[model samples]
Target: AFDPPRLSKRADYSGQMGGVSEGEDVLARWSDGLLYLGNVRRVDSIKQCCLVRFEDNSEFWVLRKDIHSCYHPECHTPPIEPEVDPNSWICRQCVFAVATKRGGALKRGRFARLMQIMKVRLPYQLSSLDWDPQHLTNQQQCYCYCAGPGEWNLKMLQCGSCGQWFHEACTQCLTKPLLYGDRFYQFQCSVCTNGPETIQRLPMTWVDLAHLVLYHLSLCCKRKYFDFDHEIMSFANENWESLLLGTLSDTPRQDRCQNLLNALNSHKDRFVSGKEIKKKKCLFGLQVRAPPPLSSDQSPFIAEQPINITHRRRSETGAHQDLLISTLNSVLGTESIQTPLNFSLFVILQPFAKWLFDLKGNGTRKALIMPILQPDAVT
Candidate 1:
């Protein structure tokens, strides 16, 4: 869908006759003839191309004619929007569907994010409490499986894929099971869990973030962790089976997590599977910590600060990775889970729980919630 700019029939142009070398700034043409910022790893004067390495570490032999000196780019995004007659509306959707579907157009390139803008139907409902899945005619909707919506409407979560609404009570979400907890919130229906590539179980970013947290967890030393928090442990215990059989990730590192979870699940029969962990108090973290009551109404313990966990970096090692995986294997597969690694994971994940599942499909987050999460500082 992208066309290289200003192609010339002749190769020997006045551009950069001195030739590129390692560490010099240059733009290199990829296989598609599109130029991207890449550093010269080495020059090949015989072939009139240099071995160029892009930021992602992928290397390519880029031709001199296609190479250009680093300067301002003419366009930041591709001009891939199909040329259509302004008068014709039907062909646009039809064209995009067939083309992108068959790998003919918009093949998940650098600007694939631009595609998220297309095909999104903002559920034009007044209140989720009153909205019916029946009203969302095109997309399928699932409510809690009691065969009825309960008397009170808890918060309704929509799937990141398929744009369907779900009652949080109906889904065993690992990210945010509790109402008041500062834990991450998300939910996913079984379709997202098991369906085709079009139906994502969780947002790619969330999966990547989870893996990043795990990656850093591999670097944690025993001394950095604080007092144990059993909330995440409880949450995992309650939802272990669902997450094991359901959660999936396409990324390499994140896929390792999914594999570990599955491996843990296979050994479930050998584990204790404690019923006591289901108690809500033990499963969720961040309750208002208070001193013991001194009298009938007053408390004695004078501690004011809450035990909070934050983020940090770590050096990766074979032992560290083994420790992190073994910790998860223990936590998810057996009862010996309350380790420093587990607590560290709890904090790094922002108390990772499963209620944020629909942010991928919730188009509103990009426009609305982003401002709240990351507001510009007043000068």
Candidate 2:
């Protein structure tokens, strides 16, 4: 039998190159008819051996003592050094999940990912757009900037405790800076940042809520979904008459009344009140089937009066859906009168409407869990 060309020891051996240590599994890759092993060891003073070891504990060695270089003549630079400092470096395997770019995920690389995640979360804040589902009665139950329809360009919001994700616009509050390595990055928004520490979070002023509701209503109108079933649109239009009069009443009630009369004269052909019916139905439906009451503990989620509510119906069918909606419309529609009557209406009817639609479904879990393969993980 012929002896294989084993890596026999030469006359000289330095053993300088750090070869695979005992108990360390080695990796090998073959390309262009050449075998590349994980480690090289010098076994002879005048020659070197390429040692190959398998994850299963097999081992083999080859002598390259007399071989010349230049396998790829086109390549000019020598191989780069590996990262010895674990703190400053992450393996290529861990680089995929970061967003280190100027705009969303437009850029990549470990460093960039770290920076991008840090920027949005940092103390310096960016833009905010408020939103509330017209269908919901409790103002606190309205979706905030994160969950609303604001376009975050698909950017994700990171959770405070678990490094999980949510749509950027849906997040109510967040903490800043994702801490990794030596540096920390600020990332949480105002809501997340101030939530627990602060006292009763003031309700979003009616003005701000109105603006948001109106803006979306116009958007829906543009889409021709004139189903007139949107609570938001109904709210805006119902308030439209009162708001206009209120705004102008600041000038003079006479001037405000004059404008209303003139407008009614010009559009005499338009059955504005008949149109008001459609708005009423939608508003009533929303107030009836709106989301459940937010926890009283959460100051941010409280319901404020002077909201839009349109109609009334008996809670005969389980669809208390329609009745709940009507009650909400009536609550929202009632004038902000400083009388006992107005207060009574708000206190009595509003809670009932909110209860009808306050359906709280358990949230879905979408967190990602990485598997560990070491004893340290068990610890």
- lDDT (tens digit, per residue) of candidate 1 on 157-206: 43433434443333333333322111122334444444211312322233
Q: Candidate 2: lDDT of 204?
A: 29
For each candidate, what is the lDDT?
A: 0.32, 0.28
Candidate 2: lDDT over CA atoms?
0.28
Instruction: Output the lDDT of residue 154, model 1.
Output: 27
Residue lDDT tens for model 2, 103-176? 22323355544333332321111122122332222221112211111121123332232222234222222222
Q: Say which candidate scores most in TM-score.
A: 2
**What clash count goes with each model?**
15, 46
Model 1, residue 365: C-alpha shift (Å): 69
**Best-performing candidate as measured by lDDT:** 1
